[model samples]
Target: MNKKLIILLSGLISVGIYMFLPADKNVLKGLAILFFIAALWITEALPITVTALLVPIVAVMTGIFDVREALSYFAHPIIFLFLGGFGLAAALHKYNLDELFAGFIMKTAGSKMIFSVIGLFIATALISMWISNTATTAIMLPVALGLISKIKERNHTTEVFILLGVAFSANIGGIGTIIGSPPNAITAANLGLSFSEWLSIGIPFMLILFPIMVIVLYVILKPKFPDMAAIYTIKTQDVFCNKKSYAVVSIFGFTIILWLLSKPISTWLGIEKGFDSIIAVFAIVLLVLFRTIKWKEIENFADWGVLLLFGGGLVLSGILSETGASVYLAKLVETHLVNYGPFLLVLGAVTLMIFLTEVASNTASAAILVPIFLVLGQEIGHFPPYELALTVGIAASCAFMLPVATPPNALVFGTERIKLKEMMKVGFVLNIICALVISVVAYLIF
Candidate 1:
């Protein structure tokens, strides 16, 4: 179907929902706008940002929020965090710091395919835990592509596995830490859990999923013995590390330290939360102020569309909260799903989130579902609220299926090394495996 027709149909669906629903007008209005936006997001009826921008438009038209309230979401701090992270990444790339780092990693991972796969996957996953998964993927992708190009006897199996090793690891890496992805921060924040608490609970899922992720990719993409010997050894650099690289290392390293120590850092600084974003912005500003990167370069690096998308999603989420739509949905879930027992309920919620994140923006998925899970936990008294929220958050980051599912997916998908069907085929199974792993782990630990 044409995108325009899909968008029009979505608008009609929202209007019809508002007109016919037996709920509060404000709630119905919010739900209508939400369904409209959700449809557009799912169908890509327009550019996601254009669809995102429609949130404020629909909110204003329906009186869900006034112009000021709706427009203010555009400059939300989370959006700034996105900018800061993107800027830092851009700076790193501008200086070829990521390349220097990627070279060092691959050189050390050695010639063997199994160890090389594990090393690259671990490196990407570990970096993703502290930075944007998109950036991590971006940094690793070129390196992977470069390596693939150098292999004179390249075949589909060897090349696909190498590219996917980085991409999949980036996705899985985001699961390990709160700063790893937007969903993690949103989840932890909404649940009132401190960073340490979130990390402790989240790490278990990561441990289980990371190894399985590597094994599954390795097994699926494993090459024949002759082809394995033909695979080129990753090239190395002897003197790439320099003053500039050290600067990248020092600044970024300090930022990670602050993030890992966020609780103590925040306490020492006397703040309630979000020391991580502060570190992100602080790192970006320092990089620019020190002439490490030009201001224009930072602008070039940042993905402003992602920031806009974040704001638009937040605005719609705000409408859902302020208008009582989330609360009503929570009660409905409580009534309908309570009888399944806490484990089953948690499994269901996380499972739903895993798929929802595939169809919508993961960040938006977290913003929309976190509150409902929180409310449901409190009202139904199944899982504790914080745990439920954490489960939803982690599951929100589990969108491993399609290009649109997450930025990391899209970054690697753009390479065209692997078919969409291949990604979907493996992604679908991994989705189930990762979801079940997370849900069961969450039930036990959180």
Candidate 2:
């Protein structure tokens, strides 16, 4: 469908709902806004962030919230946390720490193809834990290409496996931390999940998935290197150049320490907890105060649209929850689901999220669906709302079925080493496994 036509139809459908739906004035308005945004999100009629910007405008026009109230979601503390994360990532890129990490890891793998692929997965996932998945993929692509070129007899499976590993590893690595992906931050902010809290689940989730990913790809692709002895190598000494690089690494390590230990540290000092946002801000300050990075450098790396999209999602969430629109929707769907057990309920929600994200922006998908899932959690009463929402957050990143599923996927596909059919064949298998894994883990843990 034409993007313009999809957008036009979305607007008209929303209007029809507002005018004809039998509901409270505010509920009707909220539903209208929800459908409009969801349609645009599913079809991508506009940039997801642009559609996010519309949420507040529509809300104000419908009298659901005043300008001040509607816009406030954009400044939510988690947004600042994300902003700080972006700053930290910018500094890492500015100083070339990302490349150093990649080189150092891949260089340690020796000449074995299997070991090299594992190394790439490890490096991408580790870096992606702190940075955006797209940046992580970008950092690793050249390393993979360098490795591939060194072999005189390049095996097709080897090239495809390594390239797919970069993108898939980037996505899986993001499951390790709140700042690693937008969906994690959005769901965390909404559910009031602390950094450490997320780490407890996120890290374990990543750990479990990593080996599965390596095993699955290796077994399926059956990659073989005919000339492993000819693989390229990097000097470890080149990984760290000078005192400035060391300084950036020190600051980066220090920031991560603060995030992990913030809770106990707060308890010991009799300070409040949930200060990860403040820690994030402090990391940015250290970068500037120490002259490791500059304001101009940050402009090139920061992703302001994601921050705005998160805020807009929060706005819509508040309107839905406060105006009873979410409850209304949940009630309408509850009967059909009432007989299902808790495990089945969570499984269904997680599965839906995995598939939904295969087409829509995972971040946007999380923004739209997490709130609704939260309300559905309330209606079901089998589990906490946050637990269900957390599943959605984690599952949102499990999209592996299409090139458009994630930036990393598209990034790898652009290399032209892997076919669309190859990606779909492999991605479809992983998608099913991930859905099942997420569902089971969430049900047991929560």
Candidate 3:
């Protein structure tokens, strides 16, 4: 169907829900808007951002929120943090620092095929923590293919292993930091989690899952190793050989240090805590002022739509909270799902999120579900809500069973080297492993 038809159908379905669901006007409106946006997000009848932008519009129309309140979410500090993240990523790219670092990693991984795959996984995951999974995969794709080309044998086993390694590692790496993925930022924003706080969980989560991913892939794909000395032997320039590169590294490192210490820094300076976003914007200013990167060069790197989507998701969360929809939904879940036990409930939810993300945008999945999960977490009374939210956020990045599950997955599949079945074969195991890991870890940590 065309976009208009899908949108009209969505409106009709939401209207039907509004009319049939026995609830207060505010609750009805909130639910209606929720279903409408969820429909659009799942169908993708509209651009993800377009669907996000609709949240405030629908809210105003339904009297859930007024103009000022609805529009204010667009400027939420999380959005700026992500924007600053884009600036940093662009600076790294402009100075060739990212590629330089990636090269050094590949060179060190040695010529063994199995070792190279492990290196690619580690390198992609590390870079993904700092930038984006999508960009990290893009940057690493050529390197993977180059390694594949050097193999004297042409079996698809090693090819799929290497390519999928790049994709999976990118997704895993994004779980390491708040700015590493949109879902992480969404969770942090909702839970008031600082960068260092998230790092406490996220870094460990990435560190554990990436290795499990390697083990699972190694067993499933059982890739054959051949001498890859030709690829690894190439000489590369030093990453910090120049003054410009040095400047970018200093700014990047300084920004990370501040984010990691934002809370202590705030205490020391007598400023407000949770000022990581401010530090992020400040880093952007430093980059430009120092000429490490020009504003024009990196301005376009920010995913403006995703930023708007975050804003819209926040507005939607308001609708649910302000309208008491969250309370109602939490009660509904508690009444029906509480008997499943907290561990199982969380495991099932995390598993569902991973699979749901297979067919939906990970960000959209997080946007739609995190608020509900947050509310559910509070009502469930078994564990902390932020733990649930953290699990959901991390699960959002673990969809690997299909190409549409993530951009990195799709990017690798585009190479035509990996079959749908191959991705599913490997992704299915990883999905199960990750769901269990996230649920168990969140329960244990909190």
Winning model by lDDT? 3
Measured against the true structure, the TM-scores of the candidates, in listed sequence, are 0.88, 0.95, 0.97
Sequence-dependent TM-score of model 2: 0.95
Residue 308 C-alpha lDDT in model 1? 76
Among all windows of ten consecutive residues in candidate 1, which has the lowest summed lDDT?
Answer: 225-234
TM-score ranking, best first: 3, 2, 1
Name the top TM-score candidate.
Answer: 3
Better of 1 and 3 by lDDT: 3
When 1 and 2 are scored with TM-score, the better candidate is: 2
lDDT tens readout by residue for model 1, 50-99: 87888898788778789999999786655655566676677666666655
Total backbone collisions for each predicted model? 0, 0, 0
- Please give, for residues 235-266, the per-residue lDDT of candidate 3 as tens digits: 33455556788888899999999998899898
What Cα-based lDDT does every candidate model obtain? 0.75, 0.85, 0.87
What lDDT, from 0 to 1, does candidate 3 have? 0.87
Give the Å error, residue 188, model 2.
0.2
